[model samples]
Target: MTDHVDVLIVGAGLSGIGAAYRLQTMCKGKTYTILESRSASGGTWDLFRYPGIRSDSDMYTLSYPFKPWTHGNAIADGEDIRRYIHETAHENKIDQHIRFGHRVTRASWSSEEALWTIEATNDERPVVITASFLFLCSGYYNYDAGFTPEFPGLEDFQGEVVHPQFWTDDVDYDDKEVVVIGSGATAITLIPSMADRTKHLTMLQRSPSYIISLPQDDPIASFLRKVLPLGLAHRLTRRKNAALAIGFYVFAQRFPRLASRLLIGAARKRLPDDLDPRHLTPDYNPWDQRLCIVPNSDLFRTIRHGKASIVTDHVAQFTKTGIDLESGDHLPADLVITATGLQVVAFGQIEMDVDGEKVDPHEKYVYKGMMFSGLPNFAWCVGYTNASWTLRADLTMQYVCRLINHMDANGYAFGMPDPTGAEGESAPLLNLQSGYIKRVAGMLPQQGSNSPWTIRQNWFLDSRDSRRADLDEAMVWTVRKPVAVAG
Candidate 1:
């Protein structure tokens, strides 16, 4: 027997939970179910269990707008974030609506019936579900495996090797000399946390990334939480953080040289006088790639105390004891961690089709950074690359709910993006030069050069447009013909 629902949400993670909450509360009488591929609800938080696995963005903005974060730590650990997700799911009674281990493999939309036939595998058993609307909240990155570049002589290395994405509890690294490859956020976070346990720690990278230090706890947020109501305090803090982040991003984009100097200066103040400034400096301009943040200058403190170090060099090969540098130097290590990055898996690798035609994401233009061109009754929750992810996520959920309500009032069976008014060149959905994004650029959707079609990574802009934009302005809303009841 095939299950039927009003709405089918594709993920049970942060975005999925938020989507469910909005659908249940605002869009009353709509029945929805979340299909989670994994056994757990916390998508990224549950998957990543590496040392020092914590959010780089502050929790104030990373958290849902509806749920005020009571935790004191702005930079929360993976476990805490996971717990928060679970708590939200439990409190909202969304857990009962979620079907775990149900990996959606294919979805076919029928215009005649105005419904989506979703096919999935639930514990190796076939499970078919039909829904009027499909909400994809599955995150952009692949959960099964992270991006690991094959290095020459890796097989010859006798020492233990690990990737941050697949880190397990059984692996031991106490008092071991650890060398972390890549200068991204993962490496930056792992360096400081693993330094205390390791005999010596080294962060080896081909090119440096911008590293900034932020306080783990926000004094203003802390005070606001104490003085005001939780909801009001959360709103105030969320606005403040959003404004600061937007201002910084704009400043960096406008004056790249000045922004780079200021960022480097900030790092220099925390580093030892003897430490080489080049290790913390990047060749690219600020915001060219996402910045790496370390709370309380933990990374700098570890480096300054001689407990950890940074090596700016390319790896020639993995030696038996450690990695051999292209600069004719060898770094000794007992464990080598490839904090390289993640693999991009678009839409959880689900095959989507409309009216018997397969949907090629690269060929379609993104509508409002949520809906896709020529696709009806489908929306995705893709967050910002420049700011906190949840900032855009919250807006996306609200916009989707608003859209659904508009459709219901207008008696529309489904709504799809009509690009008749959209003209001009198309760009990649994400404008980031990050390795993970670039690796899967060909498979991702494209965005147009105009409003409602272009994806602006700014949170304020997205929030305003999503809230105020007219659904009928760019969408081809349709209503199924009512079948006449026979006497």
Candidate 2:
């Protein structure tokens, strides 16, 4: 069956749900539909069912700006986040507009008609939809599989090996010796949560990551909730948390050495006095990679109590019982967890084409980090790396709404970022050094050296620009240029 709408949103996750709400409130009478690939809502939050899965960033900024997170915990668990998204969608009647089990495979835009023909499959059957505007809220990661490196002798391992992305509750690990590989946020979270149930938990890493401990319950937030109105308290806490995160990021960038020393020093104070500092000291400077946050010093407390251990060494090979280290050391385990990283996929695995020409993301330049240069009526939400993801997602949706309204006011059918006169040096989309980002850098879009084209990682700057920026100067909206007739 064929469907049509004024706006078509991809993915029913956090960003998509938020986008629906914004469109409903801001652009009234604009019919829209949300195409969700999975059978349910809450894209990433619902996908991963691993133990101890929670947000590394604080919930104050991670949650939607309109919806105040009433939950007491600043660092909320995956279940709570899922529930929040579901509640928001249901309350706003956004869930009713969602078409679950529809995985969009390809989208072709017709410049003359000024519409996008989206093709997808629902329950192995073909489905098609057309829309005037396409808002891609689908996340950047590959949902099919997480990034797992090829390990030598992995096939010979007798114990169960698992990746957190595909984890299930039935895969029992109770009273088993667990060895978690990698030192990212996922590994750190899993270590503490599994430490109690396992015979012993060992966090095996090639190197250390910068880990910080913060209180789970913010005293200021708790007090504000008691005295002030709920909405005011939520906004205040969100601003405070956003400022603290931005301040730390700016400090780290400006004074890498000093920031590194202070961060390492703080981490050292949390661990046992007799423990060697090398395990906590990262070779790289602060902010080079995302910092690992453990709410209320839970990871350190577990280590100090001898429920878990951290080992830094290179893996030589995977044995039948465990892993063999290159430095003549071996770790025996009954279950191994590879918390390696994610596989980044731009545009949610959908192939995009304009006027029958396939769009190569790497070749195209990004416009304001959301819209692709020369791509009309298309925008995707990519969050900031330095701050909370929702902070940028919220701004992105607002900007898209403004653009749509601007087009309507001007009586235009198409809007595209045409960079003709202003051109300068271009750089990679993200400035991060994480394994997942580095792996897919070549396939991602590039940003220009100047404003409107450059991808801003700062929330303060992006939020300001998203609200008041003039679109006519940067974006071109008009009738499609007629195709020249062949001689």
Candidate 2 — worst ten consecutive residues by lDDT sum?
A: 419-428
> For model 1, what is the error of residue 287's alpha carbon versus the real structure, in angstroms, after optimal superposition?
1.2
TM-score of each: 0.98, 0.97
Cα lDDT listed for each candidate: 0.89, 0.90
TM-score of 1: 0.98
| Candidate 1 global CA lDDT score | 0.89
**Candidate 1 residue pairs in backbone clash:** none
Q: Model 2: per-residue lDDT, tens digit, 117-234?
A: 9999999999999999999998899999999999999998999999999998887789999999999999999999988899999999888999889999788989999999999999
| Per-prediction CA RMSD (Å) | 1.2, 3.1
Q: Which stretches in model 2 have alpha-carbon errors above 4 Å? A: 419-422, 480-487
Q: Quote the positional error of residue 74 for candidate 1 in Å.
A: 0.9
Q: For residues 23-102, could you state the per-residue lDDT of candidate 1 as single tens digits?
A: 98889999999999999999889988998899979999999999998998999999999999999999999999999999
